[model samples]
Target: MKYKKYLSILVISVLIVSCAKNPFTGKSTMALVPNSQILPMAFQQYDQFLSENNVVTGTAQANMVKNVGQKISSAAERWLTANGYAGYLKDYRWEYNLVQDETVNAWCMPGGKIVFYTGIMPIAQDEAGVAAIMGHEVAHALANHGQQRMSASQIQQVAAVGLAVGTAGSENAAIYNQAFGVGSNVLGMLPFSRSHESEADKIGLTLMAIAGYDPLIGARLWERMSQQGGDAPQEFLSTHPANQTRIDNIVKWAPDARAVARKFGVTSFKN
Candidate 1:
């Protein structure tokens, strides 16, 4: 009993000490793995992924990807600088690429590596639409969602170990195991992921607006996404919010986004 108590205390201590502040969220987030380790691996993996894929170049759409990435990334830097975090992106080497795939997805790797699928372009439809998506993906990186996810997975593994030891001699061990797997996922991991998506939406809206893109474009982009996403799992069981939920959030938050941009002297926005 004493040993278990000490073990629990040590776990709590580690968790408390492993947190770092995310400037975008103004919250202390888990960082069990440091960026020094994560960034290099991300850069290497990004290079490898591009090498393995058919990356598009020299096209108008490709140019647009790079252009919007620059604008949004610049917007992030400007926000940081104005708010007293001048060198926040010194470690971030921004790169954007367009890949020829029909996956209808775009993602940003840790440290500013981004890829946009050709499949998502039709849905994006214009520069403002692309800014909406770019801002969201960039927010994920700025908020360190990748690092937090890795830390969360580590905590999940630790919990599994504790459960294994606790149930070693129990008659209900199998039932406990099954319940732990499902219960932990539904109660902890899934909600955690959903929150990240929602947070990215809010931060992305602000970033796009600051970059002189209309925040309303975010909702329209998602309406298109919903048409593409015929059916999504229920919110409780899924990693992302439902499309309607996301759209509602964007609609409610658009004015707030514009307010943020107004501080940065952005008086007009592109639709």
Candidate 2:
């Protein structure tokens, strides 16, 4: 009982001290690890990834990746600055790379390292589609989703250790630990990830709109994605919002995105 009390206090203390504000969501979030430590490691890993992959350069597709990344990132900056968070991205070293992989994936790592897989380009079909994808990927970075994910995992591990210690000498200690492992992942972590994805979708829509791309294309892109016909796990067990849910959200959020873009003098949206 004393161990459990101490564990609870420790968790509470850590939670209070490890919180950082998410600019996009305006929510206090766990940030167990600081960016100073995480960014260097992320940059190194990103560099290593580029070295290991077939990085396409000087091609039209490569240029497009760079171009869309720039526009989306600039839009993010404009929004931040207008909102009085100027210099918020000073530490971010933005780099966009096109990789020769046939996977319909694009991701932005911490501190603005982005990679777009070749297979997604055909699905994008045009520069506007590319901007939608780019805005989404960049939104993940801008919103610090990577940092939050790492922090959540860190807390989960620490809590697991606390549970193990608190359950020590109990007759059902092993059973308790096993249950915690499964419960924490399914109940805590998966939901955290899915929330981040949804938040990214919202912020990305605003970004693409401010960058002069039609935010509705995020849904159109996903409509094509849904037609790709692969078996996916149930939404409750998945890290991303279900396809139809995302489409509905994008459709619903389009008017709000345009309203935001209008604040930045962007009245025209590309089709």
Candidate 3:
């Protein structure tokens, strides 16, 4: 019981002390790891990953990736500047690459490093589709989801250690430890990840709209992905929201996105 009390105090202290505000969401998020440290590591890893993979260059598709990245990132900056957060992305080193891989995926790392797999291009079909994906990926970086994810993982690891220590010498110590691992992952980590995805979806839609792409494009892209025919994990066990859930969220949020874009003199959308 004493060990549990100390563990709880330690966790609470860390949570209170190590938080950063997410400009996009206007929410305070966990940031146990500082970006000053995370950015250099991210830059190095991005360079290494590019070196190890077949990075496509000198192609129209590659140019589109660069263009879309720039547009979405610029839109993000515009929003920030309009909202009195000028230079918020000063430390971000934005770079985009298209790699020759068949995985239908795209991701952005900490500090604005981004990659788009060649396989996802077909589903994207056009520039607007690309913008949708770009906006979402860039939103992840802008909102510092990577930092939150890392902080959450650190907390999870610490909690595991706490569980083990607190359960020491108990008859069901092993069982307690196993349950803690599974319960924390499913109940805490999974929900945390899903919330990030949804937040990204909302932010990305607004960004795409501000970048002059139709915000509804995000929902369309997901609809196409859903038709690609694969089973998604149950929502409770998945790190991302279900495909239908994402589509509905984007659709519901599209009008709001357009309204946001209008605040920046963007009255038209492109598809």
Candidate 4:
């Protein structure tokens, strides 16, 4: 019976790992959570978050946030449709908000709930900078990085549980505990977080270019971000890639993104 249970888990894990594809790169991906389960939950949580937060209203910045979001969302739609994935965003409830906050950060949750903190405005420097950030956040959602991370986490939990169960009666309890700690901390979290950041950077550039925002500006945005270093670790040591690495990758990938944009009649973008 125990062997049967383990076999079932192994089969389920294999199935979960097989059921994903990278939206931007068209690569096979590992995701355990189905979109049907993740999307509705993401939409509900986004709505609840907006209702709870002090979202800015009737302000120029807030309006710009919405405008940029709409542009990027449209760009994503066009790309998806052109790539034979039309209606891919049908379940996405896109919403953009400029929140009253002092943190120099921005993010988009799955299902297209985006928030721009007021403090990041200075770093944004202009409409293009805002677009750059918006594109990146939207890319994270489009690629379903959050869902992938969540799924990976679930797998990690399963592995940990299996380990604990298998060693419950063993004399190597301390070894098992140590292995679980190391596996969950290193194998489960850090690398997954880093991969999400890098994927977002790549997909974000494509989205920004498709939306008529210069993809090259992505590197400049990160340079400015690097200068505003606070208590936060340099991007390299954190979950994100280092500023230099990100800039280099953006510079390298911008031309390809522009080629993609050109297919959609975006030959040039605002500097």
User: Judged by TM-score, which candidate is best?
Assistant: 3
Candidate 2 lDDT for residue 90: 93
Per residue, candidate 1 scores C-alpha lDDT tens digits across 10-75 of 477475658888889999999988999999999999999999999999999999999999999999
Off by over 4 Å in 2: 2-16
Candidate 3 local lDDT, 74-132, one digit each (tens): 99999999899999999999999999999999999988999999999999999999999
Ranking by TM-score: 3, 1, 2, 4
**Can you give the lDDT of residue 123 in candidate 1?**
95
lDDT of 4: 0.84
Tell me the deviation in Å of residue 70 in model 4: 0.6
57-175: candidate 4 lDDT, tens digit per residue: 99999999999999999999999999989988898888989989998889998888899999998999888899899998998888888887887778777766666665666688679
Instruction: Give the range of the ten consecutive residues with the poorest summed lDDT in model 2.
Output: 2-11
What local lDDT score does residue 213 receive in model 2, on the 0 to 100 scale?
A: 92
By TM-score, is 2 or 3 better? 3
**lDDT by candidate, in order shown:** 0.93, 0.89, 0.92, 0.84
Candidate 2 structure quality by residue, lDDT tens digits, 145-211: 8888887777777777788778788899899889988888788888888888888999999999999
What is the alpha-carbon lDDT for the whole of candidate 1? 0.93
Candidate 2 has an lDDT of 0.89
TM-score for model 1?
0.96
Q: After TM-score superposition, what is the CA distance of residue 162 in candidate 1 from its true location, in Å?
A: 1.3
Task: Look at candidate 1 and tell me the lDDT of residue 17.
Answer: 51
Q: What lDDT does model 3 reach?
A: 0.92
Each prediction's RMSD to truth = 1.8, 1.6, 1.4, 2.6
